[model samples]
Target: MATAASRSGRRRGGGDDEDDRTAAMRRLRVLSLHLQDPSPSSEAGLAPAACAAAGRRRATGGADAAAALAAYLRGRHRDTQARVFEFFLSRPDLQTPVEMSTAAHRELCFRQLCALVREAGVRPLSLMANDPAEYFAVMEAAGGADISLGVKLGVQYSLWGGSIINLGTKKHRDRFFDRIDNLDYPGCFAMTELHHGSNVQALQTTATFDPVTDEFIINTPNDGAIKWWIGNAALHGKFATVFARLILPLQGKGGDPADMGIHAFIVPIRDLDTNAVLPGIEINDCGHKIGLNGVDNGALRFRSVRIPRDNLLNRFGDVSRDGKYTSSLPTINKRFAATLGELVGGRVGIAYSSVGILKVSVTIAVRYALLRQQFGPPKKPEISVLDYQSHQHKLMPMLASSYAFHFATRYLVDKYSEMKKTNDEDIMADVHVLSSGLKAYITSYTAKSISVCRESCGGHGYAAVNRFGALRNDHDIFQTFEGDNTVLLQQVAGDLLKQYQEKFKGGTLSATWNYLRDSMGTYLSQPNPVTSRWEGEDHLRDPNFQLDAFRYRTSRLLHSVAARLQKHSKTLGGFGAWNRCLNHLLTLAESHIESVILAKFIEAVKRCPDEKTRELLKLVCDLYALDRIWKDIGTYRNVDYVAPNKAKAIHKLADYLSYQVRLVAQELVDAFDLPDLIIRAPIGMQSEAYAQYTQHVGF
Candidate 1:
């Protein structure tokens, strides 16, 4: 029988003597190198010097600075994230995709995720707490490793669990929160209908209050009313928090049931004990999707399901024993906002997770670039692809964005933490608007970055073992689900317009809304080529200048779109006019979001504890800001925001910044602190990747 050492040697392509000789040669070579050195320096004495030299070469302040930046970027949840990564690595069952023919693998993955949640003592209602940062950190880490698992957890804790915490009263929380947290009662969030996804107000599903039985009868009146894209509904969910139009009949003044608008209710979906589908709840699997197959998304329908009146998540709207509808808020729209506001947590969580995934993509691509060398001058050693201008162009801006979004997410999480502590109307509106816009912007950017990372790694990135396929496929849904990116941007545009109108009417503005005031003064004045012309690189680097340019661009877009909208509305009414200006509306929303990210990024960089970290990150900030400006150069150029020469300079500066960023590309990606276990991609292992490849498969 072959010995263990011999088997290992055989796998690595060797024999016993060859391995021994090779080991002896390695030791001899090290000894020779030390003997050959003329310096009297000890190994420990020389280590710091070597690190410092490398840091200088990388242009990242030094090793200490790089280390500080890494720590800051890894965040406060590193210990928890490390443990999660280790736990995932230990379980082979969790590492690979299961075949679609049998959902048993998906079920296994779900069970593992549930086990992790149970151990964490975290539930969806946890988001209601002022500090759910730890839980969100874990979710973001998990998402970076496995998108399906992260999304499943989000469905359980943020979507389904959060709805109960936000929309339901104490009675509902008492009945369900603990069980849901413990996985004793699995649930799904049912909101999107077959015909209406983004437009919840137009949903056809209804819950009619029956005075006779004192129950709310839930019904999917038509096929279009089927609740679609519901996670865990096919097999796992025991109940769902169903959003439907509330119908309460008046005693005398009634032609049809009084429309009480959209409301949420907890309806049983399956038998908790038998794990069987319940009566009146029809469910069918949505089958294969572009990604996240581990999550059993399904379409659901209710056929006159009678749930008790108390089933309503009535924190905002409630029905008395006599079937009279009453609400704490005066209007239905206010109630809808209050109830659906629970989704803000999910949106924020997605933004964090999106940054996390982008970090992984950047990490893999950067590491692979460093290890995989290509053509060089004749009779010279091959150079790293990362040294190529085009390669740097492909990745460094994305690298900068990964950092920008990282800081932006931290700021958002902190700001949201404060907002949850108060009931201030203005702050809440700001939070809602920011969360929607950031979610749309960050997810879309991450998706594009993932694509770039995949292409950067060439053919290896396309392989499942390399992890980019999974990254691209799983995250594709994020741009559509939580809130469709386009639809969410519209919300941002509407909120901005409201603030713009308020400021024009001389209403007071909060700090975040101060830009709207600035907008009225700046964009409303007129176009001036000389005034808007771009200055030099020094001027571009000025934070105040960047802020002004961003604010001006956003304001100009808003002003232009609103003006066009007014013209269309005069002839076509509000909805039709809005439709006509949809493209401009999207641009307006995106520009506002970009400006907010830049502001937060600058603020975070300023607060860096280490001078070196701050200096290095400032360059990253420049790259992020300038790259965004470059993308919108046409807009700026068209509006005379910059001279033609300045436009040319902007393009040149972007290339130069990309080259500067390339010097520290590895260090920047390393700041994310993703472990090899989570990264999984062999190419991501760098030099060892090739060795491991050669060892396993003969070259």
Candidate 2:
């Protein structure tokens, strides 16, 4: 079983091919077991028992709790996602990793997934279309099933296809859109370089226009200029949306060769008929990633490659036959901004998918907790792990956070969809800031949640059968991809400061800006007075109190950081001043984002139609907001946001709310409504887990 990856890696002397092959085989062996369904009859035998607690445990019937939650999460698109999820899950071969461990296996699986998507009659390009409900439905379904598969879908749809649709003109669309939708022209978005990831302006790859031949000469001058981490590049990718600096002779201002900033072009990487790497193009596999090894991630380099001048994706800017560059944008920076703005959809997709992963992890951990029993009183018997105060403490808060993130991600997607139709720059800037902050916050939150979920499962979580390891490994990359979380938060911080400055000048303010404006005086004046008598009405369960606490903290932190930057920039220079205050800035960004999530969560809670659902969800919301403040109660205490005794009291209130949430914990996770096919982990099968284990040992 020498994988295509192994053969190609060896052929190119990539030196890591053997290691990749070994890892794939190892992963396949472990992953294959989960693909098997432990007797459907046995599975049917277990569900009633698992749901028995739902009937008697709390006000919301236990059996219906998960289904209700699922209904809420799936929203108007649940049926669509369910159909798509079942299509992939029904095929055991498609579910297994036998065709996903090596380069060959991954290529085969990638093609299969693409074929499945096409067979479903859902076009990848439709995602970039004005109405993106279907596109997001597919993403939610695929991501829930497998993260690697979801990423492969995103690469083709959101990145490569999106680049063409959003950045290219009519000529480019007519030439490629049909083939792209049909998967006849699998493509990669080539933007990140070896020496310059995240910092696209510093990329070194060059596309020099040759006026004599009316073509562009694309080149990778140094090793650092090579495009890296490009999905589908080693195999399967026939073309790429290449981002490179545009150099034209004597074209700017006077008689000078104009150095237009990074622009995208469509370049052929492989011969369409033979699937062979084209001349002057070289690719090497990025072998054995911790997760997502199923994608054919590869590095690419170009050497004096020539393409027709028409290959430029020039919706924003274009060059004439004489090499004169003309752009509708006023400056190079604006041009580049317009180009990169197309990628905000990709960021939105990643954040949405990250929430899906969080749901899966939490579902598995919660289900396993119900079935798993540890020591109890000697006279009684073993108690389910869900009963332990410590266990509830670990899993419940994360469960609440997942719900908050789910709603927040939904808010992000709606914003993105609306912005696509309008394309208003001011609205677009707000979308960019919100998406960056959210992508960073949600992915970081997911990573922590998955890790906690894994640990909550104890020894079983570490095993492959539980699937937490893969979820954690696959999800960790989200923190860096789309944009690095840290840098993105800084971008949010910068935007906040800019908005704050605008507020001071009496400029018109947006809703969010107005909220910040109204709060400025309170944040700067003094922390609110803490009452001598601690009232539960002013604590965790009170939405107004929660909102006030969050709003005050965010505004205070944001203003403090702004004041520091104002004073320090005088002597230290702009970059130095910001660098010195990076921590405060990041804290400011995080607090702002947390406030936004709380606001969204509270609003959603108010709109819940079911009284029981509303009541329970409000408790979850309380846990989310209060736990957030509990973690940093020290800061609130220091600033008199809460008196020291009240700060301690709020911490106690947060812990008590966690217990309240624990009473309906099973129903809480069930609200996510993940199917067993997606849950995959054996421990999540309730009584079926014990049956499968015993049968395996021939008991």
Q: Report the number of the highest-TM-score candidate.
A: 2
Clashing pairs in 2: 4-104, 54-62, 66-670, 69-671, 70-671, 250-256, 250-257
Per-residue accuracy of model 2 over 1-699 as CA lDDT, tens digit each: 999987776767645767778889887754432122111122223221122232224434776766665666667777878887778776766674412466655765585567566676767675557566567767878876667778888888788989889999988888888888888889999999999988998899999999999999999999999999999797879999999999998776787777899999999999999999999999998888888777888999999999999999999999888877889998889999888887898898888888889888988888788778765543445556766657777888898999999888888788888888898777788789889999999999999989899999888888776788888888899999899999999988998888888888987655444568668788777655644235453554678888878888888888888889989999998999999999999999998899888888998899888776777788899999989988888778778778767776676677666766766877787677778788878777534875664554477
Native-vs-model 2 lDDT? Answer: 0.80
Query: Where does candidate 2 have its weakest 10-residue lDDT segment?
Result: 34-43
Q: Give the clashing residue pairs of candidate 1, or none.
A: 124-157
How accurate locally is residue 139 in candidate 2, as Cα lDDT from 0 to 100? Answer: 82
